[model samples]
Target: MSAANLYLERPALTPAAEDLREEVRTFIAEQRDSGALPPPERIGLGFDVDMTQRIADRGWIGLTWPRQYGGQERSALERYVMNEELLAASVPVGAHWVADRQSGPVLLKFGTEEQKRFYLPQIASGNCYFCIGMSEPESGSDLASLKTRADRVAGGWRINGRKIWTTNAHRVHYMIALARTSPAEGARHAGISQLIIDLKAPGVTVTPIISMAGEHDFNEVLLEDVLVPDEALIGTEGNGWNQVSAELAYERSGPERWLSSFRLISELVDVLGADTQPSTQEELGRLISHLLALRQLSLAVAGMIEQGKSPNIEASIVKDLGTKFEQEAVRVARNIASAEDLVGNGRAPRLRALLMHAQQYAPAFTIRGGTNEILRGIIARGIGLR
Candidate 1:
């Protein structure tokens, strides 16, 4: 595809999908009223097991999969709308986010019927949680250069290596890890395979890495001769690169990409009035316009997914733009708050805490999933620039 075909055609949501929004909003309101979902002082997908179970009780997880696999068989656009409402309200969806977003879908696509039966239902029921195991200590975004290895052994594979910056590794039940099972043979992306690892295995150790925001959401996971049964291997052997690439699309092109700082933006809106300066209004207008455009592009990606097409390039575009917009949101919110004198006034304590948290968290915007440079490389290659 050339640069001319790079832009995704915007998708229109079906009436059914649009109607699902109110149901989600009602659930959020109920959670809030029950004290299950409190006003967040920070801006991110929070981890709450009870909240995840409540969402699962609503059949929100795995909404697009086949009913046999415990999904509602809904459209991807419907899932997108549901997530938009949930994130806009700062719902704590971190517990089941990864499994619902990618792991379950990947299993549906490449896993055996046995694997699907064992894993999909549990994920849908919010009984199982998963985390990504891609990054290594020094690999950065070059996943092909990972040093983790899973050697063939009797009845299983023995995995040995380290995964750094693994989000929720300490809390999640399992990790879908990428490891080299054969020689590269002059192809760096070859000889790789995906394996499911139990986080509580004997040889697996997870050590917390506290973020600058003082959160334990990140961790360093080590695997020393950790053996997983042969059935743990996902899809074909020596095919992990393609699998991980597809999984990255799921990770990159979600509402979470752009909406991490939305609470801060929404709070800023609450404090800003008609008497606000024209300059702030202009900045706020531009920010919102960009958000709307990003939403359209993200929806287009969801449309592609619904049609069973992989929009890797389009997803990278959305993530790149979305993450950048997130950082800009923090900067704009800070300026607006300073201008409005909303901080330290005791009138908007939640906004003040959110601002502080967003400032500490903003630096991670472009680095997670894939760095901006790596995403741009994917974009360039897709457009025939590389």
Candidate 2:
């Protein structure tokens, strides 16, 4: 049970990630000094359209997307590495994170040629954005119970329902909505379809909800008989549930789960200085160990995704543990410094900003993507707990 044993068993980063890692580091450093980068507040959660466009201009947004969509056509592992670098630096990636991570690939796999041509290039250019419309007033984790209905109208379908907890919906142009196409028949999970609805459609209405931090990143969107064209349907009818389940495998797994508090990590290390005490080292070591474990598990999931396999159960485990690890960083950050010191923290301006940000945002780490309870239930079912 030596450190070397744990280190040796650690999954090493592929060479592609290693090379891409340095390139990203250099890019961030240049952006930081040039004022091209937003403040640390904007790093992880800020809304900076120009910065997002700059990152997209660098061809770093959709690295794994097909070349036909203006992507670099890189490996998933490479994209993983790129994302790790971006998150570690706390870049303003909110604009392209969804498209690059989940929606674009899902479209490439199931979308019609017309859909691909319209959205992919725009996503690649950082001009198009999408919000997830899976959660409804009654249906949060229990997606099959969703009541959103889509009735077939002449040239398209009329969508009517309200989606709650819709993140960034007010700012985005489109949402990938999951609607019930037909009444439930044999099973609760049947007859649902995915539609790409324009947020600016005639009948669509968006209202912002301010969170504890006074941020309006969350919104509620009411679709009142919104008419979406026939081409807006993604994948196939009655297959939305399965498609979303597979897509969650990517959404739930990745460095973002573990590294959301990276700013706090950097702050802690700096505030404690390089000459921290033994107890501090022990606590830091524990967080580092958890991060390593999550990294390996996430890497394995990335590999499966690269090979076109859905590692759903494995992703649940990674996300569950990783979010817990992120919470730990927040918990200990408070204990490491006195209340006065925390507020007066000027040791490192950027890192202090990050720690303050973490303290306010840590609670959402588990709730936003999927609650810890929801993820564990899935894992238990996967392991035959039923």
Candidate 3:
């Protein structure tokens, strides 16, 4: 197929990424003019159910999901364009972000027929949301050391463990949990399994972890003998390590990685016009360079995903670099301003809120979705240095 045809034809390879961008931009403009969406906040606390429902109503949530699953069967590039525009506008997209990003794709690729049929459509329709269940108290970055255990039962399995730092745990419907299905034997990574645990299950408990920004985003989930049916097992029983690794690439390379500070970038440009100071000018230039570089790297990974290749290392690099840039953008913005935004003095309340919010959440940009150290390890291994 021609490049345009190839891109236009599939959700993963939309030939019309540019056109899609404009369309999304127009939608964001309309939303802004209607006062339906808040001004850009640079923070990633973009969760508005009504706004999410609006996106879903417009069929943007599952741009790349299969039609049978309620998606429009768009290409990855199309979805990429849509995602960039939404995050740029700081749209409240937290509800369906995780499901649309990776969980939906993972299920489509590795789940059983029953699993796909039940969950995929709901996800595409914005009815089902998912959070990750990877880190535990004892195991934060070293996922191989996670202690969340899953004992086998006749009909299914009984899960018992605590998952910390689960984003939107209280609102999400499900979690893709990594647990020990069996002992790892001699291999540290063996016998692990991914279970699709219903958050509303009888023994499940979610406790909020209010962030420094005073937002209730992260939570600690306790799973006590939660029964997961055979259908809840994603992929093979012992291949979760590899499966979740692939999913990380999808999580790490999306527009959200770079767009978190986009609001701040915009404000910096608007407020600090032609006569910016030397230090402020230097910082802005650096942020732009890093943003563009991360974009190129992330776009390359998106191309790989469109072409059915897993670009885990590239994803990690983009995630690490993009996250750092996002944090730096906040710091630069905070420093450049006269510190009035801190108390909403000269700055708009929305901008002040977002700025203060970004200050608090900046630490999480590197911490969440895997740490900087872990990503560097992945990149180093990719280049044969590790």
How many clashing residue pairs, candidate 2?
0
Task: List the candidate 3 regions with Cα displacement exceeding 4 Å.
Answer: 1-15, 40-42, 339-350
Range of the 10 consecutive residues with the lowest summed lDDT in candidate 3:
1-10
**Candidate 1: RMSD to truth:** 1.4
Clashes of 3: 14
lDDT by residue (tens digit), candidate 1, 210-272: 999989899999999999999999999999999988888899999889998998888889867
Tens digits of per-residue lDDT for model 2 on 216-296?
889989999899998889989989999988778878998888887777777666566667667677787888888777887
Q: Per-residue lDDT tens digits of candidate 3, residues 1-386? A: 23311121222434588888888888889998999986665477566778878888888977887788788887887787788778877788999988888888889888988888899888877788999999998999899888888998998999999999899999989999999999878998999999999999999999999988777888999999899887789999989999988888888888788887798778667766687567767777887888877776666667778878776776777788888888888887787675323334464556566678788878888988899998988877776675
Q: Against the true structure, whose lDDT is highest?
A: 1
RMSD each, Å: 1.4, 3.6, 4.5
The lDDT values for all models are 0.91, 0.81, 0.82
At residue 163, give the lDDT of candidate 3. Answer: 94
lDDT of 1 at 121: 91
| TM-score of model 3 (CA atoms) | 0.91
What's the CA RMSD of model 2 in angstroms?
3.6
